[model samples]
Target: MFDSKHVRVFDEVVRTGSFAAAARNLGYTQPAISQQMKALERSVGSSLFVRVGRGLKLTDAGEVLARHAADILGAISTAQQQMTAIVRLKSGRIRIRAFPSASATLIPSAVASIKNQYPGIRIELSEGEPPDSVEALRRGDCDITLAFTYNTATEQPASDDVFAVPLLDDPLIVLLPVGHPLARRRSVELAQLAEEQWIAGCVRCRSHFVQACAAAGFDPDIGFTTDDNLAVQSLVAAGVGISVMPSMVQSFIRHPKVVSRLVAPAASRTVAAYTLAGNQNVPVTQLMLEALREAAEEMRRGA
Candidate 1:
């Protein structure tokens, strides 16, 4: 981003279409422009421009250089903006962006832990689906992302750049309305629920449902598809349908008419905490992990 007078000259010459004009633009005089061009050609070992009717044309190398130079300068500007924002944010906030299931099951407990330990640090949280939240992380809008990983047959690997840390294994479960006929059964089988309409969650989250139902020898009868945990819970509460969901989603089932039962084959989602590959904010990340562990303990005790 700094240094290289030749880069400056190369950029100017390309923009103005002639060395003399470039010299006039940069106020460097024609000799200086020629000198910079010589140095640039020698350094890059490429004839970057071709002379044309009283004007200049970029060679392929020169065009490439021009494109890269613009990117480098733009990167420098972006870096300055980032540094300025960081300077303005005296106490850096730990921005936690997450998908809904993680937000419901993991964040509150993790937040409680961060609050207890890093009281001086600001904890900002946002929730959405995985793609948008991952974009937020890529854009420097969030510090961490808590997301779910399905253990089903259809589950694919996560993005390579996302540093996913295993927090817990959340098994999928079937939720039933309290007075429904299945409520009397201690544990429900996928085949048993085959005839029952399933309330679906996220699209990528379809693996759990697909694999579980496949085990029972039939594709599930999906009645409702949604991203909201509460909406699925509400549908089940109304006896509209039963749904298979990660156990962590249990945190959202509040209606008195509904109850969740762990599925028999033990389908699960591997809950993980994600961040950029080389992030230096270890302390808060550690705190968040500890909070997740504590929350896991509380959840295990059903407290």
Candidate 2:
């Protein structure tokens, strides 16, 4: 195989038309240039140049190589430039998958911050809950995934190959109708709502709710199930049923008729950014993680 350095030297010699001139242009001695040409000729199994009086002349093979050398060098230079731009965060694309609640609250701010700071970096976002989003990360379909897990002892830890960067603790709050007696209370325990009809969220959220209710010693009377936060709030506002929601989601959108209270047992989910192990160091990915951290911190302070 022809070495890239030798090909570069050969291209320079063809451009300058002489070993001495090529050496001067490349900051190498004439002897070094001659040696590279000899090695390149050996690799290609052909003489690339011949003496025509005091100047160099291209053989038939030399002419063919010369014709392709400029294109090769140009392609190599372009590749180098693109890699440099990516490394410097001047240009790149990051694929991000976030859970719905995060997509509404944390992701918007984080995406905006990254866009403002590095306009050349393109971001593609899609909404997905954990396990699905985690699967996407493992499949290389996404570079980063914003996910959450309930901070319960029964919760399973992330897989060994996944890297989780803790962003914040998103507390679960009770959403009740304005006329509900507990609406006037500062906080409500899980057991207090056992008798009321309940509206559940996504499957994982629903599972967590059940677990929390079980911990409180009751099987909740779930009357409605939906993944839409707005729908959940709307049901509560209409006095159809009460629901529990992430404080982050409540902060982003609230129904005027629904009142939110902190949970007495203080249940929360650990929100984090997940990437395939070792991908957190990728330039664009790292920038996004940093933006998420900053956004999460701001939300924490606001809360």
Candidate 3:
């Protein structure tokens, strides 16, 4: 018989990006996890993952297994939930993976309430970008994942079998060095800053960067690229370049040298919380929704 434990191990390796991480999460020795994977492959008579330069990636067969494993795990969870609901069970753990902005933006206050209300329940948090977070939810790595990006909520992207609960629409803003020529302007246009140096995001995540520059009718002279938002902001503050970021980036602003301006054309982003479709509801997820509402309200008030 197929072992659910081994399937979970496989999912963990995929979720965290490494066998070491999977071992850490599953509290097993790395070799033990590797052995389990080897046994699983032997049982299935096919290799699920191939060694790729210091990491592992799912083979075609592995991909199929990964996808089905998540569904199976979700179904098992739903079964337990149905049983719990019959008895009115009040508490359980909530696993969450989300973008950096929403990790604390909508999760903290709500989690505080959850802790007070259901002291027995626990929360596990993980940081990830939107696509990865969505994938994690579908793969049963998390109960919910809060993700955000430009126009993602308005124009939901093609995602495999998952559900998203729209949370808020956030505005994007431009960051300028205080001494920038356009700093004192009441509002700025994307076109006006086209000639300025740009700090772009990591690969495969330049959607906003592309849109902002495209609106300007000229691609920006992107000089730096990194996944670290703080590093990008720091570079902007140092006048290395200017960057277009969401309003949430403002929360990290402490440099008097930097000024954040809301793009006059109403450049904004869509933020939302996602969950696996056709799965049982999690009360902690509801708490996160409430927390996000509060965060959105706070942003509006500040605006």
> All candidates' lDDT scores?
0.74, 0.90, 0.76
lDDT (tens digit, per residue) of candidate 1 on 184-296 = 77678888777888888888777557866787899988878987778888888888998878777776556688877778866677766677766634655555656766776
Among these predicted structures, which one has the highest lDDT? 2
CA displacement after TM-score superposition, residue 103 of candidate 3 (Å): 1.5
Pairs that collide in candidate 3 are none
Candidate 2: pairs in clash: none
Q: Using lDDT as the measure, name the better of candidate 1 and candidate 2.
A: 2
TM-score of 3: 0.65
Global CA lDDT of candidate 2, please? Answer: 0.90
lDDT (tens digit, per residue) of candidate 3 on 180-269: 998998778888887888887755446666865776699788888876777887898898998877777567444667888878788677
Clashes of 1: 0
**Alpha-carbon runs more than 4 Å astray in model 3:** 1-90, 152-161
- Using all chains and alpha carbons, the TM-scores for the candidates as numbered come to 0.62, 0.95, 0.65
RMSD of each: 10.9, 1.5, 18.5
lDDT of 2 by residue, 1-303 (tens): 888899899988888889999999999999999898999999999999999999999999999999998888899899999999999999999999998888888988998998897899999999888878888888889999988887655554477888889999988899999999989999999998889999999888898889899989999999999988899899999999999988988888889999999998788889999998888889898999999999999999999
Error of 2 at 36 (Å): 1.0
The Cα RMSD in angstroms, rounded to one decimal, for candidate 1 relative to the true structure is 10.9
